[model samples]
Target: MIRVTAALSRARAGLMLALQAGLAAGLAWFVAHDLFGRPMPFFAPIAAVIALGSSVGQRLRRTTELVIGVAAGIGLGDGIILLIGAGPVQIGVIVLLAVLLATAAGGGAALIVQSASSAVLVATLTSTTGQPWTRFLDAIVGGGIALVVMTVLLPLNPLTVVRRAADPALRAFTGGLHDAARGLADADAGEVRAAVERLRAAEGTFAAFSAAIDAARENVAFAPARWRARGALAQYVDGAAQLTYALRNVRVLLRRAETALNDREPIPGVLPVSVRHLGDAVELLRQEWDRGVEPLAARERALRAVAESGRAYREGVGYSGGVVVAQTRTAVADLLRATGVEYAEATRRVRQAIGWTARPHKARRRSGRPGSMPS
Candidate 1:
């Protein structure tokens, strides 16, 4: 059943691709015939490739930028052509001017190269008789049509895109959190290193999604939904940070505990409890933040387990182990305090970031407007 479903999904995607291609071809043909009087040789194909290669969000941005670039290019190109007359020298001057203008406009180096190439193409192709302005307009119209078709017919929904991205990001963070917790319990250096690497990979994924969110926000069609998704992602990031800190401190405590256990010294009773509590806190934060499911009961249970474990460890320590026990106890106490503070802050920040009303002041500052405040 799963195989069949996957096959059907692939078929549907293929059909959509075909439909978009056909529509773009048709529109391109119509525009070329109507505007140029003679059909364009390969312009439509080029435009279609650009449209298909770009995401809906990026296509919109690039189109806006291209339009502005073309408009400036045409005005500058025409002025140079008129002043210098149609000669090899005039075309060379137009190319130089186009490159300079594109560079000055902060269009990036590649764009300046493209702009210069486009200017040379226009000058060469229309040197004999055709109007440079008209040709420029035709190219712009083709690109614009391609943009519209891509935006309207086969629109990539930002909400769907972000939601898809969020799943992998959440999984990565959750897996790293669990691995880090287990690594602390075992005092395994290799596992700890692996967990840190996984967290870093997850961080990279979050950064990419954040960039996508920013791009989507600039899109008039997807802005509101993208903003909402961005808010949700910010919550997940905060939760991940909390989980990370808790795991780090727990890992340190476990290392200390291992040293005491190996030295045949009395284990500090509070040490085990602190490690367990920190691990529980991380797990609870992951569940609550990622799934939006309240796990307060689970958290309470974990806290109790930690407390009991700490009591047991303390009771086992004898006078012979007094020095190690005291040292470990002090370290555990400090870690517990730090973890508790971090967990609380993470919870508060996650709430605000996710649009929950639990932290109004922070939410207000994040609202992107001046002091209107978030209810």
Candidate 2:
């Protein structure tokens, strides 16, 4: 029964993909044959399907490439097939030529596949049906219509798209910090190790968020309709980058924490509590990003958290404890830098607020690098 249910669920997951691909293919075909009067232009719908099937983050760039790939494939195949005549050898040559052309043009997997497939169609099929450059024309038609359908016909709010993508990564990062703090508070080496593992896994989220930022940038650049969002999107990208930097440092902190736990170091509970405060700052960062709310209070809260943790450290922690505390200070500095503060100024702000006095032996500003993301 469980197996049957799982299979059904998996199948259901494909429903949207099927719907999107089918509709795109149908519309592409209609535009190519009905509107453009391209006779039996089979490559048109294929281009549209490929465009719509690409991942959400960079659909604009991918669609443009797909259109170019289709044209490149058709032109190469048609020219080669006409010159050499249709045969298995001609088919191989056409494919090689298409691949070389697409690769030389800096096309990715989608373009390469489209080029190869389009070449195959031209070489194997009868020349009477797909005249010289007819498939290329069809590709133009399909690709243009696909862009129209994507951008104008069924437009999504650009900010909404970026926010949706960013939320998952942000949540993963915040949750990891929370769990790490909990483990630290409990002095559980095992729990710290687990938190570290989760933080490591969130690297994929980091990459995804980075991609989403680039996608949002591209979306805003190309779509005049989303021009008003440009400033907000820039701020969001900076914040997301800072968040990624903080998470990376958090991973290192968690590892050290695990080691400290194993060595039976007396990690002050105040330290973990401060980590929880940073987590709150992360939540507030999300609110600021999504709703354009003020983050000044959240920033103050985070600084206070770090300062309190610092005061506890000044009372005299051991070597490992001091290292962790320094890391926290750096992390705090990173968060501040993400708010568009200059590097030195951010350092000054964090140090002044946290009352971090430089020791003769230790290097200053080792908490974390400038967080250029969070604003």
Candidate 3:
């Protein structure tokens, strides 16, 4: 069933790509005929293919850069053309000026390629005629056609991508957090490790979502609200990272508990509440991430629960049991406290950094040392 679903998804994606390609080709043809006053030769097809294959977001950015670069190149080229005279020397000066201008604009390899292509276009179409502006306008028209086609036909909307990606990523994060919390509660080392790994993978998915948003921003036709949502989603990624780290520490503590149990002694009364609170926190984070909104009271309640669990664990280990068990409990309690503190700080930092309202509660402050109960 899963394999069939996967196959269907791939097929749909392929269909979308085909549609986008066809749209780009049709638009490129129209623009070629309208601007050049005749059917375009091979270059129109080539340009359409390039535009279709290129990332819509990246192509838009490159177009803007190219426009700026071309304008600068023309200004310099014209100056050089005037200084030298209309001859082999003039053409040579134009090429030199194009390269220099492109380099100054921080055009790497792609810019160099664009510069060479633009230089050729100027030389063949507009050189010695004393009008670089006309050729510049032509390049803009070509680029504008490409941008418009991309925006209007089968658009690769970043909001849609981010929204689609956020659902699964949030599920993974929440599910992983739940699993880790259960593992911590039950003192199950393997489950905790697996959950943490899944959470780490979810972080990568969020990164991809962020990249997609960046691409979408370059499309002039895209909605401003979509851009704002993307920015909001980017802020949420930092929160997710902090949650992942806290969960990872919980896994480590679970491992320590496992080791102590194997030694025929385990920490007394340490697992249950810790896991429950952690799970609650994970769920809250997942909700916020998916919806791009958070309830401060709910988040604060979850944090308090986790902190309480850490406190309980610390209290349970205060007495010396067997040397091995006592030391193990102490270590686990320290880990839990550290993880809880880190999680709290991460949530607070995310709120402050993003200008979100801070929860109206007393700030949590951990004792300077590990053995003390978390406050």
Best by TM-score: 2
Question: 204-308, model 1: which lDDT tens digit per residue?
Answer: 666555545544444425334234455445443333333334334433444444444455555444544444444455445445545545446434534443444
Residue pairs with backbone overlap in model 1: 269-313, 269-314
Task: Judge candidate 3 at residue 168 and give its lDDT.
Answer: 67
- Every candidate's lDDT: 0.50, 0.73, 0.50
Any idea what lDDT model 1 has? 0.50
Worst 10 residues of 1 by lDDT: 323-332
TM-score per candidate, in order?
Answer: 0.53, 0.81, 0.53
Worst 10 residues of 3 by lDDT: 319-328
Scanning candidate 2 in windows of ten residues, the lowest lDDT window is 366-375
lDDT ranking from best candidate downward: 2, 1, 3
Q: How many residue pairs clash in each candidate?
A: 2, 7, 0
Give model 2 RMSD, 1 decimal. 5.2
Residue pairs in steric clash, candidate 3?
A: none
